[model samples]
Target: MSADTSAEWFDPDTTTFGDRLAGARELAGMTQEELAKRLGVKEKTMDDWENDVRDPRAMRLSMLAGLLNVSLLWLLTGEGDGPGDPGVATSYVRGGIQLMEEIREISVQMKLNAERLVRVEQELNELLRADDAGAA
Candidate 1:
């Protein structure tokens, strides 16, 4: 995900509307101070919203989406391709879905590979022990 927030991963099209707002805020290099200035909100208020400490009211959500230059639909539902670019949005959603499946598949494969490595290491240890015993 983008280094815009505390979250290790954030997909605007996949996260809740509020999360998308936070993510976009981060991407734009907006500090709570700067954002607050632009948004006419108190710093604590911005902080709470970003951390999910508080939910943005409906009117606030509309303002946030506009301020962040993202689509309201994407911000809220993780649906639609993106804000205004339908083609880009479609590609983004498709890629996000595909990437999730690929990551899961790789995780399973890696687990299997790790198991094989453990077995091989065990065999090598046994072989080394046999050599040492023979020498003794």
Candidate 2:
């Protein structure tokens, strides 16, 4: 948690540079292979960076921050603008689920309404035919 009681997505006290790197990469919706390919590094190299077995060069670090859409300072120290708190992600997922459920309900209602409309049309056609036959 920070000074204001908001839980940070990444706590510098407990997490290492590798942890931050991996977290940011995942949030960016990237696999290690994709990121490594974009960064012109081997998959093993990216794994090394994420495993704390090696660090990136300064230029590579800058590219990484830009590619991940996180501030370089945050990537290094977990203090500046990075991914927001984990709560935000949870809320987003919850909202998505609610929307999906609503859509499903609406779809069921529409199907029922369509069936009723078909029945009404058939009844109307039958009445018209009976009237025509009586006139004839």
Candidate 3:
């Protein structure tokens, strides 16, 4: 847990340098041991970095950024939009907005379904009531 960052930023595409390292490992479907194996690093060294107990040197940072397909500027300063952006960040923002709109539409449909279920239940109850009255 980084004191400076939100937990929502656990993805390498959206976090500070150290946290991004952890996220990149996850995105690559790598355990710390697996990452270590690939990087020729000891697992303890990887752990130390993830835990924020140590920082990587420039060469290691460069290697990590390249390996993860992210920008050094993003990894170092968290300054840019993200790795998913092209030369400019407009497309990423547009993509994110589009995804949000999609989720909103789904949410509206879910609410409508819930309301329909309630109406169905009420109709069934009325049918049962009518049947009981006729029997009595």
TM-score for all predictions? Answer: 0.48, 0.56, 0.48
Best by TM-score: 2
lDDT of 3 by residue, 35-76 (tens): 676555789998998878898866566556655555567767
Please give the distance, in angstroms, between residue 57's alpha carbon in candidate 2 and its true position after superposition. 0.1
Clashing pairs in 1: 13-78, 17-75, 81-89
lDDT per prediction?
A: 0.61, 0.74, 0.62
Model 3 score (lDDT): 0.62
For model 3, state the Cα shift of residue 54 in Å. Answer: 0.5
Candidate 1 structure quality by residue, lDDT tens digits, 1-136? 3334344445643566556655666655566788776555798998888767788766566556655556567677766523442212221222343345445545766899999999999999999999999999
By how many angstroms RMSD does model 1 differ from the true structure? 16.4
TM-score of candidate 1 relative to the true fold: 0.48
lDDT, candidate 2, equals 0.74
Candidate 2, residue 72: how far the Cα is off, in Å: 0.7
Most accurate candidate by lDDT: 2
TM-score comparison, 2 vs 3, better candidate: 2
Residue 101 accuracy (lDDT) in model 3: 48
lDDT of 2 at 131: 100
The per-residue C-alpha lDDT of model 1 at residue 111 equals 100
